[model samples]
Target chain A: DVKVTQSSRYLVKRTGEKVFLECVQDMDHENMFWYRQDPGLGLRLIYFSYDVKMKEKGDIPEGYSVSREKKERFSLILESASTNQTSMYLCASSLTGTSGYNEQFFGPGTRLTVL
Target chain B: AQSVAQPEDQVNVAEGNPLTVKCTYSVSGNPYLFWYVQYPNRGLQFLLKYITGDNLVKGSYGFEAEFNKSQTSFHLKKPSALVSDSALYFCAVRDTGTGGFKTIFGAGTRLFVKA
Candidate 1:
């Protein structure tokens, strides 16, 4: 079975503070993603990395950045935490293939609260 | 652009009754649809997917989805409902013909099963 793990399950930060959320997948997948889930908005992609040292912006990537220094680890960085950034953060990974029909395995989300 | 829509915000059903969660999608080309379930404080778990071939695709935990090309829908269904099945459900889609790794998710539907 594939397993994805996050660094923190719950976090609280003050406004304008830098926050880091880490994700690691044991399946050695080539694609990793970061998303913020909110009520009524669902899951909006923040950023994704297809390979080590490669990153791409998603629908809502503002005020967020990503790092993929290694294949197993992907980190989401909040430049300056704001109240609007308070939400559940999810990470997912999938194997690379010709068809983009691969199932993405997810981690047990990180709920961040910005004060 | 590809997009997915979950018409219902929530669905309530009694145990042993049939349950259905509606999901519709739009894409310029061939679509790769998927269904996922999320428990409280957990990330989304892959339930099933529709790539090609069979219109009715069976998935995990007795869940299944039927793909309707004319209607552009991929609705998730189950024979009977259980209290353990209560969770948030999301539908996702990606344009395989467009050749991008981005997958768009619906707003999500909360399933409530009463014993």
Candidate 2:
């Protein structure tokens, strides 16, 4: 079975602190994504990488950046954590996007609380 | 611009009763629709998707969704509900733009299954 693992399941950070959330997938998928899930906002895409070293901003990418140094790992960095940024973060990976295939498999999410 | 809309904010159903979660989508061409379920603090799990087929697509954990071309809707349903089935359900659509692959999610619907 394809497995997407996240570095932390729960995290607490202070305001103005830098935060790093890591995601790894064993399926060798070429596409990796980072999203923040909130109550009424759903899962808003923060950043995505189609290939190693390639990244693109999603709808709500402010104050967030992504790093995809390897094929299997994608990291999301919060430059300065704030109380408003506290939410559940999810990481997903999908097989190389094709004309017809784009099924994303997600990892266990990390719930971050900024104090 | 591609977007997803989950009509219901919450749905409550008794165990052994049928349940439905409604979703609608907007896109330029034929749309790729997806359903995911998030439990507690876990990541969203892929439930089902509708690319192109018989409209009625069966997926994991006895869940199925029917795609209506005319109405541009992909509504998820299950014959029976279990307490374990209670979770936050999300509907997503692929944004087929030039930049890269991105999935747009809707404001999730919380499903409460009562025993």
Candidate 3:
């Protein structure tokens, strides 16, 4: 079975603080993604990495950055956390082949609270 | 742009009763549809997907979804509802014709099964 793990399940940070959320997948997938889930907003993509050191912005990538120094690890960084940034962060990974029909495997998610 | 829509915000069902979660999508061309279920405090789990071929695709935990090309819908269904099945459900879509590999998710529906 494929397993995806996040560094933190829940986190609290003050305004203007830098926050880092980590995700790791054991399936050796080539594509990794970061998304913020909010009520009525669904899962909006923040950033995605197709390969090491490669990143692309998604629908809502403001105030967020990503790092993919290695294949197994993907990190989401908040330049300066704000109350509006509080959300459930999700990480997913998928294989590159099959004409992009691959199903993404997700991590447990990190619920971040910014005060 | 690819997008997915989950019309219902919540669905309530009694245990042992059949349950259905509605999902509709719009894309440029042929679509890859997906259904995911999220337990409390857990990540979204892949329930099923429809790429091509069979219109009805079966997935984990007795869940299935039907792909309707004419309607542009992929509705998730289960024969029996369990109290344990109560969770948040999301529908996703990816445009196969578009060269982009990004997938869009719906706002999500909360499912409640009463015993």
Candidate 4:
């Protein structure tokens, strides 16, 4: 079974602090994505990495960044935690080719609360 | 623009009754539709997908979705609604002819299964 795990299930950070959310997938998927979900706003993509050390900005990547130094691990970084940045952060991994395009395996989300 | 839409924000159903969550897509080429479920405090989980061939697609947790090309809709349905099935559902579509592995997701629909 495909398993995606996140470093923390819940996190609280002070304003202006740096925050890091880690995600790892057991399956050897090449695509990893970070998304922030808010009420009524759904899931907004923050960043996605197609390969190690390669990254691309999504719809809302302003105050957030991501890293993919290893195949199985992807990390999302909050440059300066703000109350507006608080949301349910989700990590997902999927295969690269068309055959595995639509289905994404997601980890349990990390709910971030900035104070 | 290629996009997916879930018109209804919420759907309510009584236990043991049938339920349906509506989804629609507007994209170029053939559309690959998918359904995902998110339990409270959890990340989204892949429920089912319609790639090709059959219009009816079955997925985990006794859920299934029907892809209708004429209606540009892929509504998720289950014969019997269970209280445990209450969750946030998302509809997504993979853009086929856009020359990328981009998937557009609906805002999401909350399903309330009443016992």
Candidate 5:
């Protein structure tokens, strides 16, 4: 089975603290994405990496950053955690081309709470 | 600009009743539409997608969606709703203008299936 595993299922952090949420996919997909899910707002994309060391900002990338040093792993970084940043973070991976062939496989998600 | 809309914030249905979750999208170029389900405390899972040929797309968990190109809608449907099917549903459309790597998601609709 294509698997995407997150480093933490739940995380709590203090305001102004630096946080890292890791994600790894066994599928070796070429594209990876990070998103934050909030009530009523649904899922908002934060960042997308099409290849190693390449990234694109999504609709809501203001308070987040991402790193993809390797093909199977992607990491999300919160430079300065704020109470408003507390939300469900999700990571997903998909195959190379975007021509309707990409089916994103997602991790279980990391529920982060900023205190 | 590309966008997705799930007009209803919540949908209530009884067990064994047919359920429909409405979705509409606006995007430049051909629209690659998708539907996802998120269970409590879990990440979103791809339910179905509409790319080309057939208008009706069958997906996992006895769910399906019909693609209406002329109407710019792709609504999710299930013949017999199960109590376990209660969850959050999201609609997404791939942004071709943004190189098709970014997917715009709807605000999501909470599904409540009463026994």
Candidate 6:
């Protein structure tokens, strides 16, 4: 079965601390995405990587950065955690194609709480 | 650019009854639409997707969605609702014509299945 694994299911960080959320997919998909989900606002994309070392900013990329050093691993970085940054982070991966296109497979998610 | 909208913020249904969650989308050309379900504290799960051909798409957990090109709507439905079926349902869209496959998700609709 295709699996997307997140490094943390729950995380707690103090304001101003650096935070790292990691995601790895076993599917070897070329496209990986990071999103933060909040009530009512839904899931807002933070960053995405289409290939190794290639990243693109999403709709809501403020205060967040991403790294894709490896093809299977995508990382979301919070340079300095803030109280408002507390939310559920989701990671997803999809293949690279044009015939039928690819659908995203999401990880279990990481709920981050910054106090 | 592609955009999705889930007009209803919440939908309430009694257990064992059929339920429908509405979703509409706008894109320049043909659209690749998707439906996902999110349980509390869990990440989004792929329910189903509509690429082409058949308008009705069946997915996991007895869920299905119908794609209507005339109305530009994709509504998710189930024959019967279980307590486990209650979740936050999201509708997403991505343009397959030109731009990269960057999915845009709707605001999401919370479904409550009551006994």
- Give one digit per residue, the lDDT tens place, for model 6 in B4-112: 8999999999999999999999988777899999898777888999888899999999999999999999999999999999899999988554355588899999999
Over B1-115, each residue of candidate 3 has an lDDT whose tens digit, in order, gives 5678999999999999999999999888678888999998889999998888999999999999999989989999999999999999999987454354578999999999999
In model 1, the Cα lDDT at residue A50 comes to 88
lDDT of 5 by residue, B1-115 (tens): 7789999999999999999999999988888889999998788899988888899999999999999988999999999999999999999988887777888889999999999
Residue A62 lDDT in candidate 6: 91
DockQ of each: 0.77, 0.75, 0.78, 0.70, 0.75, 0.72
Off by over 4 Å in 4: A97-100, B96-99
Q: What is the C-alpha RMSD of each candidate to the true structure, in Å?
A: 1.2, 1.4, 1.3, 1.5, 1.2, 1.5
Candidate 4 per-residue lDDT, tens place, B1-115, comes to 7888999999999999999999999988878888999998777899999989999999999999999999999999999999999999999988565335556789999999999
Q: What TM value does the first chain of each candidate achieve?
A: 0.97, 0.96, 0.97, 0.96, 0.95, 0.97
Q: Write candidate 3's Cα lDDT for A24-114 as tens digits.
A: 9998899999999999888999898888999988889999999999999999999999999999999999998866558899999999999
Regions of candidate 2 where Cα sits further than 4 Å from its true position: A97-100, B98-100
TM-score computed on alpha carbons, candidate 5: 0.96
Off by over 4 Å in 3: B95-100
Tens digit of per-residue lDDT, candidate 1, span A1-115: 9999999999999999999999999988999999999999999999988899999898899999999999999999999999999999999999877664488899999999999
True contacts kept of 1: 0.70
- Model 3 residue B59 lDDT score: 97
Per-residue alpha-carbon lDDT of model 1 for B9-103, expressed as tens digits? 99999999999999999998777899999998788999999988999999999999999999999999999999999999999987454346678
State the fnat of model 5. Answer: 0.75
Candidate with the larger lDDT of 3 and 5: 3
Best of the two (1, 2) by DockQ? 1
Q: How accurate is candidate 4 locally (lDDT)?
A: 0.90
In candidate 6 the C-alpha lDDT for residue B96 amounts to 51
lDDT of 1 at B66: 94
* Per-prediction fnat: 0.70, 0.82, 0.78, 0.68, 0.75, 0.68
Sorted into a CAPRI-style docking class, model 1 comes out as medium
